[model samples]
Target: MNIKQYLDSTYLKTAFQTGISETENEIVVKNAIKEAIDEGFKLIMIRSEYVALAREMILQANSNLNVGTVIDFPEGKSSLETKVKEANEAIANGADDLDFVCNYEAFKNGDTELVKQEVLVATQIGLANNKTVKWIIEVAALSDKEIIQLSSLIKNIVISNFKEEDYASVFVKSSTGFYKTDDNSPNGVTIPAIIMMLENASPLPVKAAGGVKSYEEAIEMIRLGVKRIGTSSAKAIANGGNIPNQY
Candidate 1:
């Protein structure tokens, strides 16, 4: 319930065997993931196709790391129908959590309704199968005005679609690290920006990704109101960044 419960202090530390683009030769990445699992990094996020394999990998490591994957990924430009299918397939393949991108075009067109509907569909589908649906807002891609709009719309959607008894959780995440240019925090996911979102996002946990590469950075995010951090470095933070030759 406290802030630290949501911090992803060690992200890259979990990048041992990434299925995102096929780490056919980088055995170190795979080894790191296994080591991270054994080291007790319980929440692990992998690509859609890698979820089942990662799940099996987790088992082989003899660890209980929860598995999660992204939908629509970095762009959030996928059609609603496509996103729905991605969510279905990911969940069916054994994903415990889903980070979906925002429909920027929908928001730009002032289609708040459409945006909410997209989230609602995902929320509904994920709920039916007992999965968690977290919407990735890509804070860096939007303006201040757009961010506020997203907050208001997200707030409305949470109440309208997810009933308390339904047992589903909706979240607004910042960054997906899929941007072609940079792989760092927010691009604009700064402390102030995230703080603003988290303060207003009542009942919704904010997952901050990108630009979070250190314990101080991760802790800063928590202090700024982020409830969870979508980091891949689980072991580094737990080790004070002293892992021998850790990438």
Candidate 2:
């Protein structure tokens, strides 16, 4: 099924959180890069601080993999200027795809302008750099109505501000994988949420992230029109196994 091509083999963790030293974290990152190269995944998504290192490793291996990073990460509350600067640095570090955490909290609060501005600025930066950009809406934290609305918002903004051909460079993605409900419910892409996004954000493409732990789920997500699958278990999925949940 060329499943590896659909995967964005990921490793995004701070040394503090993982309780590993910075050098240990890099070792882990390097292992992921090597695994990606050996397994032929389409991309390796890591934090921005490691973009250059990942890029160099991929280049050294003579692999055709893309380097990706997250911006504003698990929280979408960063100011527009900060997101832009982060994106710029990632680009300079050789990131080919950027998954940006959208300001859904603001949108839910009726501050649509803030959401739009944040998206517009990030999109502009990615497009100007000739890179692919994905807007992570953090679906597990939203209602069905909000999913449709936010997906539509991203589509509308990109369509109005960018050229038609550039539409392919933009994607409305499903989650940050870090969101949790008050009751500690699982957070990430669900079938219904992705269906809403696909229906509302037509022609803009979608990336399903989080909770995709097996080949079966990944295949189903692709069947439902997802262009990318973000998961730490890419290798496991490729081998028909499951790994612990990662965001």
Candidate 3:
């Protein structure tokens, strides 16, 4: 398999999250962007602040590598307006695709309308801008039933609100790679969780993110019907190696 083509080469660490200075964080982002260009990965997924820079770099290199950004990223607790605004700004800055963290907590709390509203508005913004939009439903934080519900929720919203031809642009992604677990367990995408997502979010593509560690694992995800694989280890995976860190 051409695993690099399925990879969304990712670097989403903030300065505060890494305990590094802003300059150090920029280096990490720049390195990922360079690798994506040199290696011909599918997309370079970065924090929104660097979308413009990544765009400029990709243009300079004359590569068709896409620039994707996260919205309401690791945390999905932001207000709907905040998420939509973030998405708009990222698109204007040259983001080709957007991965949004769905407000899974709200849906689990019985606030289904709020969850639906957030996704509806965000998906609209992306579709309007002719960009791909993937909703990150942190599977580790949800029960099996919640995964089914949220995955179907996103699919249903798109089907109801968008034309049939636009279905391919929306995806139900598996994780944000940053949710906390009580036992400090690996909270990344799991086979069972992805199966649930695929079955429930039918017709809409699924992206397996988080702990996809190697080329073999990525192949497994694609075989199971995942259309995208999000990982910081994309270069390693493409090289048939593995990285130790989850992100």
TM-score of each prediction: 0.82, 0.97, 0.98
Model 3 over residues 102-164: C-alpha lDDT tens digits? 888898899999998888888998999999999999999999999999999999999999999
Query: Model 2 clash tally?
Result: 0
How much lDDT does each candidate structure score?
0.68, 0.90, 0.92
Give the worst 10-residue stretch by lDDT in candidate 2: 238-247
Per-candidate clashes come to 15, 0, 0
TM-score between model 2 and native: 0.97
Model 1 residue runs over 4 Å out of place are 1-29, 165-168, 180-188, 242-247
Compose the digit string of candidate 2's lDDT tens values, residues 1-247.
Answer: 7989999998887899799999999999999989999999999999999999988888888899999999998888889988999999999999999999998889899999999888888899899989999999999888899999999999999998999999988999998877877987778888999999999998899999988978888999999999999998889999998666655
| Evaluation by TM-score, superior candidate among 1 and 2 | 2
Cα lDDT of model 2 overall? 0.90
In model 2, residue pairs whose N, Cα or C atoms come closer than 3 Å (at least 3 residues apart or on different chains), thus clashing, are none
Q: Using lDDT as the measure, which candidate wins? A: 3
